[model samples]
Target: MDLVAINLIDGLFYGLLLFMLSAGLTLIFSMMGILNFAHASFYMLGAYFAYQISLYLGFWAGLLIAPPLVGVLGALIERYGLRRVHQFGHVPELVFTFGLAWLIEEVVKFIWGNNMMAYQEPEILKFALFHIGSNSIQAYKVFMIFTSMAIFIGLLFILTRTRIGLIIQAALSYPKTVEALGHNVPLIFMGVFGVGTALAGVAGVLAGPSLGTFPGMAVVLGSIVFVTIVIGGLGSLWGALIASLLIGWMTTAAASSSFQFATLLEFFGMTPPADLDESYLRDLWTLSLPQIGPILPYIFMILILVLRPYGLFGKRDA
Candidate 1:
């Protein structure tokens, strides 16, 4: 029970991280119809930028500055680099982003070197926030949870209530009509793209210390974020949130449990091979869910595809 409680809290924190990154990706994809291969690269950039800024100004300042800086950089990329490729259609745009992801990785290596930075939590937030039985919950994790919740609420409000959001929705549904009505649709696309990348940047800043701030950090989280959006349904914010939390809990629960397939196989009347060392199925018999927790998202993704085809909340057309 204590383990379950601990894993639940841990999973929530991790889920928020995934939501932050996926939310931005959803916005960009919904507005621009581009699967940003460089989205996680921007996340890596955020961590590196925050780490650098934190050296001079401290963690809070890094949190404040890094995301906006990333947003501006994203805006520039959309206006100049991506916009230029847009005329050539999605294949070229995808290739552009794909090559851009590699470029960002190389640039990150050049600037930060191929090492994990000392991106520690703030001194003020270093202590345990609370405990579940013998397990202590760190203040930093609580802060991250709060930050994500705030961002989620803010995003929801912006999309549902704000004038700009209405305009964005209008542009999405009727880009030609919206433009005919005098709204700047292309500018809206650029803005959405920038905001999306910036949100990923925020997640990067929060995750860096916990996950390790390294050059390959993007590679580590990149595919998972894609899987998150896919499982949640492409371009669906609520779906992203649901899928993120589900994946988070699923992975955490799997990792925390000690259940093994061999035990289940025994219940099904399968005996362990006497020559286990040489048996082709030895690893399968010995493997635990924890050992393969990371792959659970992919499994869940395939299951979703086979069943729903679109996603939990994805539109039938999507």
Candidate 2:
């Protein structure tokens, strides 16, 4: 495979990882009507928690342990904190989460320190899986891909097949009606929120070694996850998936390519200024996927809002 194809695959995998973290976020915001800024903090927590667990047990065991612990934390917060704030209004609820985000980061820094932690992939999955031409595919990445796919499929099953899923769906559309129908809506909200945060935690556990366990990591990726939901359409799972993939591919492709601006200038028969800094253009020409990955989702979000206000798979009213 060419460099372009390899980069595209890399971005796609990264995007899927983002989707795992963001989809649960979309569900929480769309269903409960609260934007959780701390969602990415939970992802950070997952990474740290997994690191701790992996030290005692193993990487796989840490994966299993971290998410549930994060889920419990989320459930408690929702039951105690958010439920009380809901009596006020959406603004306070949002502010509370925003505060919670700051608190989580501070706590993380206190516990893990402000520096990036030393984390590594398991030895069994550390090597390259195969080589395609000049490109090599890592086993850890393949593991990440399959793990993400499993989570996606598992989520679909839970949200579509079970009785609780129906109730959750109903609550998203008509909370009052669901409450009136004699269901424990609050519990459902707590469960979903916990589940959602737990998913973010899982992403952290999987990504932490490669992404690093750091204090500012949550702040770095938090807004982009929100932007992913907005671009995908608020409360739409499929929309989030599509948006993630689109942003991932666009950023990766743009970063890997080196377009000749000089060719365009030559085509127009134009000349550069004698003292103009060619260094800046040289740096611009050499831009790579990782550098530009952060901004891609926001750009896609703007485009989606302008072009398709309802998003790709989002219902118009939703």
Candidate 3:
């Protein structure tokens, strides 16, 4: 029971972190029709930015300032780099972003080297908030959970209940119409892209201390971000949330499970060959759920794609 409780809380924390990372990518793709290959680089930037800022002004200030700074950088990139590439079509856009990702990684390695930064959570949040059996739940984990939940709620409210949200949504489908109404459609696109990247920045700010701040940090979570949005259905916020949580819980549960393939084979009355040393299926029989936990999400993604090509909540057109 204690193990179950621990896994549940840990899974929720991980799921929300994934959602924070994926939300920005989803927003950028939905608005600009561009799948940003360099989005995770911005996330990496946020962590480094926060780490540097925290050295002087402290973690709270870094949390407040790093995201906006990253957002401004994103807006500039859209204005100059992506905007020019947009005229050349999707392939060029893909190439541009892909190159940008590599460039950012190289830059990070040049600046920060390959070592992990000494980033740690604030002193205030370092203590345990609660305990389950012998395990303690740290306050920082709870803080991350609440912060992510607040972001989701704020985003939901903005997109559904505000005038700016209505304008942004309208611009997507009727750019010329929005332009006729005295709104700059291009500026709106720039703003959406900036905001999207800022969301990614926020994820990095929160995840840095917990996940480590390093040049390779972006690479660790980069492909997984795409997997999340694809499984949730492109441009579907609800789908992203659901998929993130599902993946979080699934991976956590699998890692906690002690079940082995050998046990399953035995249950099915398929005994391992006595000449186990040379048996073709020897390795297969030795596998355990925990050993394969990291790949569970990919497996789940494949299943989702096979059964529902459009994704769980994605529109057919999407």
Kindly list the per-residue Cα lDDT of model 2 for residues 77-173, writing each as its tens digit: 9999999999999999999999999999999888888888887899899998988777899999889988998888888887899887889999999
Best by lDDT: 1
RMSD after Cα superposition, model 1: 0.9
The order of the candidates by lDDT, greatest first, is: 1, 3, 2
Estimate candidate 1's alpha-carbon lDDT, on a 0 to 1 scale.
0.93
* Model 3 lDDT, full chain set: 0.92
Ranking by TM-score: 1, 3, 2
lDDT of each: 0.93, 0.86, 0.92
User: Higher lDDT: candidate 2 or 3?
Assistant: 3
TM-score of each: 0.98, 0.92, 0.97
What TM-score does prediction 3 earn?
0.97
Against the true structure, what is every candidate's RMSD?
Answer: 0.9, 2.5, 1.1
Off by over 4 Å in 3: none
Best by TM-score: 1
Q: Which model, 1 or 2, shows the larger TM-score?
A: 1
